[model samples]
Target: MTHRIALCGDLLDLTADPGWQVDAGPAVRFRPDSCLLIDEAGRVAGVEADAAAVDAWLGSAGQRVDCRGRLVTPGFVDTHVHAPQLDVIASFGTELLDWLNTYTFPAERKFADALEARRGAELFLDALLACGTTSAMVFPTVHKVSAEALFEAGEARGMRLLAGKVLMDRHAPEGLLDDVEQAERDCVDLIERWHGRSRLAYAVTPRFAATSTPEQLQMAGRLCAAYPGVYLQTHVAENRAEVRWMAELFPAARSYLDIYAGHGLVHDRSVFAHGIWLDDADRAVLRDARASIAFCPSSNMFIGSGLFDWGQAEAQGVAVHLGSDVGGGTALSQLRTMADGYKVLALQGQKLTAWKALYAATLGAASQLRLEHEIGSFRPGTLADLVVWDWAQGPVAQRRLEVARDLHERVFAWMTLGDERNVVATWVAGRERYRRPDATAIPQPAR
Candidate 1:
């Protein structure tokens, strides 16, 4: 059956261009009483300012979902997330290296079983949709079955997902290790099978410099080159200890970023997670390569990693995005991630306003992934991946919204205090994927 939905009410349209940065404060267009029409094709048909105009256009053709006083915005885009790590979120204690050895590795090894992988993928995707995230770049375990399972799950749900099998031949468990020859073969097989299929895309994942040998990193780079527009994701300078280890592992390289750059892994499509310890030289290299950093503030704070230098990253012209970095990240909510990000920057005497934080999680992250045109904005012809936020979901939130002087203050209150519960509904491609039962009454589908 053809599906058409009209979401009518307050809307927060992030009309800013893709290049908008933190320095461009509160540059969003908020419509207090508006209507967003999604045609049967699952694309935004139009946005109307007058409710009467919207009614005239609908004219008994589609279902209208009333959101008279709620906040609607683009679906959250998670730039970096680990699907298998969902089970290990919020594990106590330990910094980067110790935490990985103690928790992350062991949990990820469970993905070797296809059933476990499928189960994990289902749970992860459900959690993401419930939290208002419609698209993500994911890292599955080293097992090809893990990537296959994730791809299958994402395809079934019609999600836009970018994932790759983790490639690590050294400094890891034997069960998780894949030699250079086997790693490249499996990656090629996975890419051929899954890349550009449905809404699923491929990323060449190396785990990190410490986990992969020079040969393996080169293979990852070669894979990226072989598949035009394929992405590259890996860790870098996330921990001081990890940085030192990488330096010792690749002594000939000028810096940690040099290791990836030397292997041709650093490029516009590359997304390096953490980047908490990036030096000026590393920033320069990233700028030159036009690479992006997934600024994982929640993970950084959860695992006691150092604060990310947002100021320096901006000053150096390096593209920055946000991530949950789950397990180590403590939560899957982008709202939580943004809140933690604000606190992290606050510690450094910097401020992340509500507008910038929300932008970083949506269009900003999409821009970093080079998917701004398709997923970031509500511009006509874009996919109808939307999040409807109900400010009155809770007493505290309701009270806060009641006093919010303007759109900025209302958004600030929501982001700082909101979580998955506040997401009234999450829509993917104009189909209602998740709707909070507790939110204000929504119209039932027409017979």
Candidate 2:
């Protein structure tokens, strides 16, 4: 049976990287009255604005979803998050190292139980959907079962997800540690089982330099080399104290990033989270390698880590995308992360425009993951993963929007004030993955 959906609404899509420019006109394509057509194969068929053309396409068979009073955009993609740390979202009063020992590790240890891992996986993905995130690069625990559980859950939901069993062969609790040999076996098994399966992919996750031994890091690098397209995800220069400790651990290495570079892990597919303390040389290395950084502002602030220098990053030509870094970060919603990012940039006298934030959460992130053709944009043949955003329903936000005189101002207000409540619906692969229970789309009256 052929299935189709015609989503009519206010559509906004990006055509280019707007960078830090306040003016979004050159990069954005906005259609006030438009229909996004999704075909049976769950790819975008077309985007039509002509009334006659839309009617002809919809015919009498397609499901016409009325979104006249809403904003339609591609679903968010979170570059870095920990699926096992769902329970530790707001754990209080500890910096990066202590917090990991106190909250993150203990929480992840629960994933050793397959049933617990499955449950966590389901809940974590559901929360992400509710928060309007259709895709993410996730970190599961060291246990193979943890990665398996997340993969299974993501596969069932038809979500584009990248995840891997964490490699932590040293400097951690016994319960959360995997031997280097066993870790390699598990990673190979997972890659064969999950990578390129439906919308699922495997990432070689080392947690960070501090957790993995030299041998384990070497093994991680080898997996990236062996598996051609598998991704490499880890942490670097997130906190000053952590950086100091890492320097002590690898005394001969010129910089924290150099350790990964030496091991052959620096590449376009590598995504290092929280690069808050990296210098120009490190930025140059990342730029040259085409490795991107996942700037986790919320987690940085929440854990008392220092602010990331966005100006320096952009000046050096290193790509930077947003990550909720949930658990250490406050919320799963990328909007909140974007809002937090605005404050983080403000503190440094830099800026994060609304367009830039949206671009980062959607297309920019997907591009960084090398998945732009498949998941990010509304281009014909791209997957129909998208979100319907309700206009400000809350009193405060409604008032702000009412007073706003321009599209950019209104969008900026939405970014600053919006949360999950504004997400009326979320679609993944042309399926309604999540719809707010109390929400109802504004009907297109009498055609």
Candidate 3:
């Protein structure tokens, strides 16, 4: 059966610009009463402004979704999230290492049961849709079954998801540890089975430098070299204590980033999470390698991790993306992530504009993941993964939007005050995956 959807509304077309590196702000094109046509393959086929043209194009077959007053934008792309740690979100009072020991590792151990893994994947993915997140790069537990569970759930929903079985050889509890050789074998097998399957992709995840021994890191690097386009995700310089520990663990290396670089793990597809404490030399190396960083502001603030210097990172030419880092972070809503990010940068005497924040959650993050051509924007050939935001949903939000004069103010107000309650619906692959019960699209009058 063919599928088609005509979404007509105030659309936010976040087209990419070469000047984004310098400005970090997106060029948002707002097209009111515009109609976007999504074909059966879930790709944007055409965009028309005249209702007559849209009706003629539909020809009585397409499902016309009226979104007159709503704001439609590209679906969010979360660069770093731990699926199993959804159970541990908002745990109080602990920094990086201690938080892992007390809350994260223990929670992940439950994924050893395939049933629990599946259940957790379902819950996490469902929550993501509700929060207007259509895609994400997720970190599952050390268990192979946990990765499988996440992959299966994503596939069922036709979502673009990247996930992997975490490789941790030491420091973690025995239940979560894997021998280096066994870990390598498991990753290879998973890559063969799941990589490039549907919209699912595999990532080689080493649970940061602290837990992985030299041998394990070497194996991880080798796997990346062997597999083309398989992403490598890990932590780096997230906290002062963790950075100090990494320096002690690899004393011969010049810096923490050097440890991964020495093992051939620093490359274009690699995504380092929470680069909060990186020095100039470290940032230089990361920039030269063309690697990306997942700037997890919520997690940094939640776990008492230091602020990420966006100015420093941009100056160093580092590719930066946003992540909820849930559990360690606090909330999965990108709005909250933007709000927290605003607060984090404000304390540093810096500013994050609403355009930059939304771009980071959508196209900016997609570019870092090397998936901009497929998932980020409403470009004609891209996937129709989109979020419909009701700007006038609540009394407070309604009042704010009423008084707002320009796109910047409207977007800033939304980022500063919006939450999941503002998400009217979430669409993945042109299919309505989630819709708020009270949400209603403005109907197109008789034409």
Candidate 2 lands at a TM-score of 0.98
How do the candidates rank by lDDT, highest first? 2, 3, 1
* Candidate 1 wrongly placed segments (more than 4 Å): 17-26
Candidate 3, superposed: residue stretches over 4 Å from native: 17-26, 440-447
Report the number of clashing residue pairs per model.
0, 1, 0
TM-score per prediction, in order, is 0.96, 0.98, 0.96
Best by TM-score: 2
Best by lDDT: 2
Which pairs of residues have clashing backbones in candidate 2?
89-327
Better model by TM-score, 1 or 2? Answer: 2
Window of ten residues with lowest summed lDDT in model 2: 438-447
What's every prediction's RMSD, in angstroms? 1.9, 1.6, 2.1
Please estimate how well model 3 matches the true structure, expressed as its whole-model Cα lDDT. 0.87
Error of 1 at 380 (Å): 0.3
In terms of lDDT, the poorest run of 10 residues in model 3 is 17-26
